[model samples]
Target: MHLWYAYMTPRTIVPVIFGLLLTVVAVEHIFTMTILHGKSMPFSTMLLSTSGNGSDLHCPSVRLSARVLPQIALASYPGSGNTWVRHLLQQMTGIATGSVYTDEDLRLHGFPGESLSNGSVVAVKTHQLYDETFYDRTILIIRNPYETFLSLFKYIKANHTGAPIIDKYITEWGSFTANEIGHYGQFYTSWMKHLDVLPIFYDALKQNLTQELHRIKVFLGQSGIKGNVRCALANADGNHLRKHSAMPLDFFYSKEKRLAINLLINQTRKMFKDRFRNVSESMGTWML
Candidate 1:
């Protein structure tokens, strides 16, 4: 605290802090946009390459495994626990899943998914829109949208290294919330329309790991690996995730604010009502 005060006072800090913070946020935003569109570009060439015909964009060469299992796409809105799924699945199969946004934790546990040339079957996890060309099968994971946004808010806060960035985050909260809600709604509606997708509900997953694991194994044609479920659960440690979702009651701050948020969630639900009504028990955790 003393060291921080030596460099500046509160009056001199906001602009400098906002500038640096905005740059990081902006670059990360660009990265997410490109990854969502391309689903597999390496960072070095993500914004660099173009198609031969000059009308399209092509990602730089990725060294891919010649002998690989069917590629499965594990996808969800950001903060819907996509990384957790990768960790568990990798533990179970002794194979790694890749992501568009590389995580050091994933690297420590398995391998960087974008450059996946490993001979084992690999799952490519992403928050990208449903891209048919990216995988042979798809897994779409959904959490309660309200909780998803709230978790995302906390996640952005967690990623900051020095002082808290809550002020800036709150300033930008309206934009962030709008984009996330709209994008996830479209993501759910679009992906669920597909005939091949295997859906996983985040809350249900936390409630019953064994059941979800069995279902995923069957979906990925790895039913033989069912025995690895316990080890995978033990290794994945889902309880840690539960703590992340524990927001204080006053987090929303006002009854009116909560009502508005609920209204937005209701509209989103109605947008996909026909598709989700029958599957509410499994997919509509947001309704509760």
Candidate 2:
């Protein structure tokens, strides 16, 4: 009876240990989700939702271009709504968008062609200012630097998830604002100098999605797009887009930081006006 009891104890203890480990892992996952996403959901449901299964959201079937396409760049600074625009582009064109950097979350979500920059996809996403000859054409998306900095800070803090900035990050905001302000100004200013570039404002895109999408479609030289612009407009806020919850400027930045950001904004507006003299005043008004 003693020999039998010893063998049974080891077997039972092994299963108990395995079960405890799994429970710990599950709890940790739930905690992370709550912190990052602002709510705790069932693990299976989270997986299904993120993977685009068992959900009501419209997930477009995106594919690589049939033929080798030109290496068109969708360029922007970090937190400039580049991913949202990519979602729109993919929906409208039915062609997959490639990114210079591989994001596993983005890859699993919808962007199957996450890291192919060889021009098989319609356009490749890039945040850096590449050489003039690298891209056949470029689409530069510019957002307000103040908002851009805040969004980027939140993104980094949440480990690149679509999470809002929590109060715990207030201490870090000052330093982050100081450092990123110059880079934000430089990214748009340098990219605007590119001859084969079409500049799009992030605010304008949100305000007039259909019109902006039509403008992009024409620029991409797609005379007949596979996906409907109307449908794309209806589903503009796809899964990839982060919810825009506007916090007061003072909440994130000091008066000094605001002044610095405003100066850069004015300089960028002047540079943009000088570069694209013929662009409509309405199109440029968003900078103000």
Candidate 3:
């Protein structure tokens, strides 16, 4: 190889070097986008990043707690049963969970006071969609899509200012069911696609408390939990949240509005039907 190079003309070597440089540039462009997309990096970082500098992409990184802390993510779609699970877990294991959003009480509940510098087993509850770098163990809370949208609609109406019932419902379902989270069904699939996530259906939590509790505990690596699952669930049930619920006969105010919202959901499901085909088929059989 040395003798060949030594005997080569400058013209031949120059062209070869130029070709190799172009190949490197092309490879770098594709490689940067592929890995960054896989990591689900932030859009802002992607916008700001240059293909030439792969480091510019933001990758999700789990911060190690200095001590024996095993961080678990309790992530769910908003209006899912994430909070209910939190209450149950706290009651069962007596370990308080933390939220990314400000909930000072949670931070105080057995979490490392020094900003997670110590290894304390703290489950962080989040409404964000799946991103694998967050944690190996995740307890995903899933709710019936219709029920989820209804809860979100009511919550938004009561809390933040928004459009009319049907309009708001349609808008939300069409896009942005979760901010920074993917589409509704995509969010579920993303978590389920990975082996590490344990999905806890909301109905099961309500109807099959014992079984769901067992699954939740097992996923969080807590085995042999005593009979407090039922007790914990019952204790958490309350009148306050129920009081704010939309009236029994006037949730959407009319059948027409319900149809409009349903139509929007159908359109969305049709466009992405391959992944959400079952959800769409179920919606078809749904009663008004």
Best by lDDT: 2
- Candidate 2 lDDT over 1-288, as tens digits, reads 466446566768888789999999987887676457432133244421232243343334577877888888999999889888887888677688999999998887777789988767878899997668788788888888877876787688774456644664666777888899888777877787577878888887877887888788888875233455653554467675655556665666667876787788888888888898865534333332
Q: Residue pairs in steric clash, candidate 3?
A: 67-119, 69-119, 69-120
For all predictions, the C-alpha RMSD in Å is 18.8, 11.0, 20.9
lDDT for each of the candidates? 0.60, 0.73, 0.52
- TM-score result, candidate 2: 0.74
TM-score of each: 0.62, 0.74, 0.51
Whole-model lDDT for model 1 versus the true structure? 0.60
Model 1, span 1-288: residue lDDT tens? 468648897878888888899999987887786555422334354554333345433323223334556657788887788767876775566555676665564454334454342235457777777766656677778777767776666667664112235685568666676666567667776676555677787887888888898878787665232335544654455222424534453463345545555665676557545555544533333533
* Cα-lDDT of candidate 2: 0.73
Residue 169, model 1, lDDT: 54
lDDT of 3 at 14: 99
Q: Candidate 3: where are CA atoms >4 Å away?
A: 1-67, 104-121, 159-182, 222-234, 238-288
Ranking by TM-score: 2, 1, 3
- lDDT, candidate 3, 42-119, per-residue tens: 333332232333444222211222345465777787766565566566545544455666644334432222233123
User: Which stretch of 10 consecutive residues in model 1 shows the poorest summed lDDT?
Assistant: 56-65
